[model samples]
Target: MTSTPAFPPLKTYLTIIACALLLGGCSSGDEPASEPPRVALVEPLQPAEPQPEALRLSGVVQSVTTTQLSFEVAGRIERILIDEGTRIRRGQPLAELDRVDYQLQLSEAEARLRQLQADLARKRTLLAEGILAPAAIEALEANTVAARVARDSARRDLERSTLSAPFDGVVARRLVEPNMVVAVGTPVFEMQDNRHIEVSVDLPEIAALSIPLGPELKAEGQLVIADVSLPLRYKEHSTQPREGARTYRLVLQGEPPEDYNLLPGMAMRVSVQRPPRPQASQDQFRLPLSALQADSDGGHYIWQAADGRARRLAVELQEVEGDQALIRGDGLQAQLPIIVAGGSKLHEEQPIKVQERN
Candidate 1:
């Protein structure tokens, strides 16, 4: 058998119940602290209508004209007045062949011509006096004419013995040395005209088709050489693909600055400026630079505040100026609120509170 415990007084019971209520109320009221994410917001600027996008492609700078010089007649190279890297003016003698043999041939031809002329003169006099036949005088006159033709031919050969510069250029290579016998049309020197240069670039088939052909594109673009930007003149393009099925060649001509020496085979950039097509989506926007964030996979993203949550949108970054970025992405709207500051700490669809800035 167990004895029953005595009941407590009403005041004590009330005090105990009150204490229990207070503990239960305190336990129910306790909660974890939560603060809304503070983010700096900026309104994206509406991209200007028909904004021009610059296309940059790399190319090699080369001379517009390159030539190989040679003589017209076979002879021994008597003298080479210039060496490699020699700057030459038009009509400047670059190399010379031995002219002694040519000179001798010219002299012999001249002597033959004089003898034939004298004989013809005597025959003419005799024919006029009826001492020589007409046929004999005609034969002597023909011989004199043939001799004169030979003399003229010999003179031309003599003049052709010297090789001269056809234009202002720098000598790239000297193929023959003094005393070296060279045949007719043998390359003696290699020279380049550097006053004007061309940039050679290979573009994909699609890009090539978009560009205007010769002389029409000169006003559309310029080339970047080191720190200088020079106007480009459209030269030519290849119809056939090179290296790959989609690559085609484009040649653009430009003059080098007088103060800067632009040599052939130098690498440089070509920039083409043109307005966007009329039917584009017009979704590209310029936002503050701080709004951009790079993902670990090398993709760019921007945070936009929508429905009180942060939305991360992938973007194709076009160009970045001091504090503004030209970006293109899907679902981009004009004047959308972008999180410029505190975007690095954001997550997808996270709660966000936009902080207005002055």
Candidate 2:
């Protein structure tokens, strides 16, 4: 008699739960209030694989060194040996001046030297014969020495009439031609050493400091100098601050191409590589920027679909690059399916129909 109080039928309770599920289940078409949008599905995207180690940078090519060539004597240029862009050898005569005036001075000095020689010989003989004082004989010898010195000075002046190249270089520009009047020390040619070339590029101070002195910065993709790679040696250092920001100057050296077609002031693009970080190279899955979803508490997440049902996953974004984002969290990988194309239209724990990206 004690425990026989009747309870509601089990079938009634089961029927009630069934009705609730029917109401909550996903709607296909015009169940208007319950229907959801068709979102794009995306597979996990990975970073581009690393190829051969190479760095690219942007730079302008210029001559290794430049020098101004000038004359040692003032005179009209008698002959022009080179025009602009003509290559010349070291010590080669590039121009010459009229030598008549200097030659006449040399002749005059030589004649005086000959007359002094005769007089000095006469004085010595006369001194030995006791007809001349010893002091006068010594004075005559001194005059002979002065005449010889003048002759040597005139010889140097005559040689300076021929202007020669101080170093092997190309005559980059000519300021004077044949019969052109030029003063002493006037620059007649702008010369540049075209054998070696340098590539210089400006970098932000932070980036420049990170670059090592001898790192091989390769020119990749499209470049002015094709298929030819050169090892870099750091050449110059400079520091200047602009707009309260600091920057550094860097230079690299390489040989000119065989065509010798490389010219000064040609610009090229370059790229520098950031060394790998200890934690940055971990195994993880990355997705497109469209895959990230946020929660009310400001947490990041993604919607994972499995067997036609969806589950919400908490994810952490390490970095974002362009259209892709690198992320790591529980159960994020290729083996685990997630929605990429439909991220923005999803609710946590909502059922998902995964489809490929359109």
The per-candidate count of clashes, in order, stands at 0, 7
Per-residue C-alpha lDDT of model 2 across residues 316-341, encoded as one tens digit per residue: 87777667777888665565666776
| Candidate number with greatest lDDT | 1
User: Every model's Cα RMSD, please?
Assistant: 11.6, 13.9
Candidate 1 at residue 69, lDDT?
Answer: 94
At residue 211, give the lDDT of candidate 2.
58
Displacement of the residue 43 alpha carbon in candidate 1, Å: 19
Q: In order, what lDDT does every prediction score?
A: 0.81, 0.73
TM-scores vs. true structure, each candidate: 0.63, 0.58
